[model samples]
Target: MTTSTTDSSTPAPGAAASTDERIAVVNPATGLQIGSAPVFDAAAVAELAARGRAAQPGWEAMGFDGRALVLRRMQQWMSDHADELLEILQAETGRVFEDSVLELAYPLTALGHWARNAEKYLRPQKAAASSPFVLSRRLRSYYRPYGLVGIIAPWNFPITIGFGDSIPALAAGNAVILKPSEITPLSIEVIRRGLEECGMPEGVFQIATGAGATGAAVVDVVDMVMFTGSTATGRKVGAQAAQRLIPASLELGGKDPMIVLADANLERAANLAVFGATVNSGQVCLSTERFYVEEAVYDEFVSRVVAKVSALRQGVPVAPGSVDVGAIITADQLEVIDAQVRDAVAKGARVLVGGQPVRGVTGRFYEPTVLVDVDHTMACMTDETFGPLLPIMKVADADEAVRLANDTRYGLAATIVTRDRARGAELAGRIDAGTVSVNDMLTHCFALGLPMGGVKTSGIGTRHGAAGIRKFCATKAVLVAPSFPNADIHFYPANEKVSPLLLAAVTGLYGTASRVARATPRALATARRLRRELGR
Candidate 1:
């Protein structure tokens, strides 16, 4: 909504803000104006979309190997200029060095992974015919890129979510238009420069930097949209994409739960709880927002978590090792965090560590907090507290834990900690979340081979694995009939003789008891063989 910038201000060189209207970029860590990005209205987004469309054919013509060459070089560019990138990221997002380091690391792996794996993942497949009628025909499917894609990235983890997602889209042979969050648009300018230095074709990848309006414009213009943000915003984007008949892949909010069993390693679980919930100032969608601990070890787990949280240093992140927790990205978000904590306290939740914003700080920072005696009625337990807050609840058993974990509308991810990993995994299956980690937390996001996304209100579609790259593509099925008769029996005229033959064939293949009787023994034998092999 704040769309105007000072006339005296100069735009960042090579920034995509071609228009006079600009969105001022502020350093959440310092509470200062760092830079500004152009406010691209609907017309500007359309123009950029057209440029991307023009460049797409050339990029697509380059083929997978050619794109990989550019992407690999970009990876090298990131390594060479890591400090500059990280500084920009830290300034804009207010993430601590360690958290920012992880943010940068993701894109490095993503660039290489998508570059190397895109072709293999999207390669044409020879699909087997499902019916006897099509047995003579060769059925194959191939993926083709959408000409242009728009990525609406969130303010948190701008580099990882902003550019990381674009890697697969670009590798899939689509030109990408990235609309980074207005809160942290500066870092993306640096990334855009790196891509150019890496010899990526001009206009093949462009940044449309502005606020929500710009993001909406991008959704309106591009062939497909991939959005990562809050669930409420995701729903709007999804609706817009639906209206245009474009596919939308949204990775939205999460109130991810962590369940610690009675037999769990309290030390490891506590360590992860502190790290998972406090990292990125607990702004991650995958952050463990609430905990459902088995009653037997609840006291010990809470004590350990409180100790670790109390030790965290919250302040402005000026440099590496300066603080364990950095400032919240905006005052609005800080207020949200404060309100949630206060609401929890009002509802009889006791804050064991921190319950208020850090005092005497120029920038917004909330102390790493641990809450116990929390329940489903509390905001901290129900709503997404995307801040440095962890609320732990004692559940009678794993069944109750699973029930409480699945009770929320969010189903992004959940974690289970137990010495018996088999039982942990069994409990994980019962938790209704897209990703369930046994004896671990947040590490599943790094397993690029596995698809990650959410269900229910959290998100639709996924990122990573085959789906990540393929979602940028449109699949085509090709069927070839080889050595076909001049006039097939099933072809034109309603032949009475052909009808009976077809009926007999269908009945014999599917409906007949004789067919089932003949196949039963073999099926049983195969099942027995599988069981024996699995036992071995």
Candidate 2:
């Protein structure tokens, strides 16, 4: 994998606006500019929104069943075009085809789940009975769309993260204006082209192409912004959304942990740890950054992880039949990762395998590295390296493991490898991360029914299954009175002391069996009479 070698020879008909559009689409697998386009100006952004607004009323009026059919069709269409989508994904991110296949599957599964279940989860429902005798007053809650949704997605797993939000937002009856990462716009283009081919309304899923400025414009105009990227940038998006009184679901960053119990199968734990940390060259939000192992098992885990890391292969992204780790997304990201690892080493961390750069690899490929004796103060441990770097620390027991795991500011995900089921549950409870896996790795996020969002700096709001679809809609409470007015309950102008009296009577009735048993019929009759008079 090399730095971007984008295909910028000629514009693809209508890929951009003017002839001088300056958007460069780079292939992270081999630092090449494989494509180029125009940076969308504010006018383009407004145009996208205008289209969404036009499509809104009709699309939303179709009801849940109508939407579900379209979504299911899209799912089948995605499955049919899986090979084509995988090609684009591989070209953009340089991930192995198998990994790309897995990434693509996540959004497809989520879309299918939401389409089939959106009505049940997002449709209006009557709220619980608020007050007895207040039953005549009808009250309900409904989820309403936020008009158009702006999703500014990152490059890593571009399809899933970008379209994942888009599926629900569209299913819940909101139009979507998606600004996919310029680093990997091919997958975004595929989605856009597919939507267009499906006869979906033009503005229902607008595809905007550009860099950070394009993403910022998305945040500027939309009713809601769903951003997935760095913590620092997430804060900026969050603050802007706040100022505009719009909600932003920001998945900032994560320094995820992997806790290995002493009795764990060290071999399985090591294999997964290496895969989790080094996969996709480790540009993952939930990449295992810190590993807290029992003192008895630390050495074994470290040795195995180091050996696995050393054996991984790196090559051009489009290479077939070989597991090739791709390059870091950009040169700037490469610099950031380098600094983190260097600082970590400076701060007492020891590199175990493939620590330095390889001479033959052309792109931003850092060797899959394992570090031991890493402290919390080390940049590799504290900051999001987002590279093929893992730091293993020794802990005396589960207490210290939990303590160290929760020490970070971000709480996205963590894993506990243990043979004992009861002990896994106990340790899972003690861990502060949002998603925890017991005796396994690489799944938690793909569970369509699970609500996956982070606490602390990781994110606000959720996206995946039930929560995702419901999140796209707004809750509106509908209350209606009986068609004919009843005069018996109309004591509007009175002292309203009846409220307290009724409460006291109900409280007395619920006080206890001993008190009720000791009370006379006369006392109970008086309470019953008050309740009847009050329309309870």
Candidate No. with top lDDT: 1
Q: Could you report the Cα RMSD, in angstroms, for every candidate shown?
A: 5.6, 3.8
lDDT on C-alpha atoms for all candidate structures? 0.85, 0.77
Candidate 2 C-alpha lDDT tens digits along 1-536: 23334443222223335234776776665666666655677667776677778888888898778877877877878889987788767767767776787788887887678878888788678765445455567788878999888998888878888888788888888988888777777677677767666656666787777787778877788888889988888998899889998988887799999999999999999988988888778888778888899999888788888777777877666556576566777777777777887888888888877676545655567777778889888888788888888888999998998998999899898899999989998889888877888987668767767877789988888777667777666678788778766453435654465554544555544567666555556556655665565555
List the candidates' TM-scores in order.
0.92, 0.90
What lDDT does candidate 2 reach at residue 135? 53
> Which lDDT value does model 1 have at 285?
87
Q: Which regions of candidate 1 fall more than 4 Å away from where they truly are?
A: 1-18, 513-536
Error of 1 at 136 (Å): 1.8
Q: Write the per-residue lDDT of candidate 1 for residues 193-231, one digit (tens) a residue.
A: 888789888888888877888899899899999999999
Q: Tell me how far candidate 1 lies from the true structure as C-alpha RMSD in angstroms.
A: 5.6
Candidate 1: which pairs clash? none
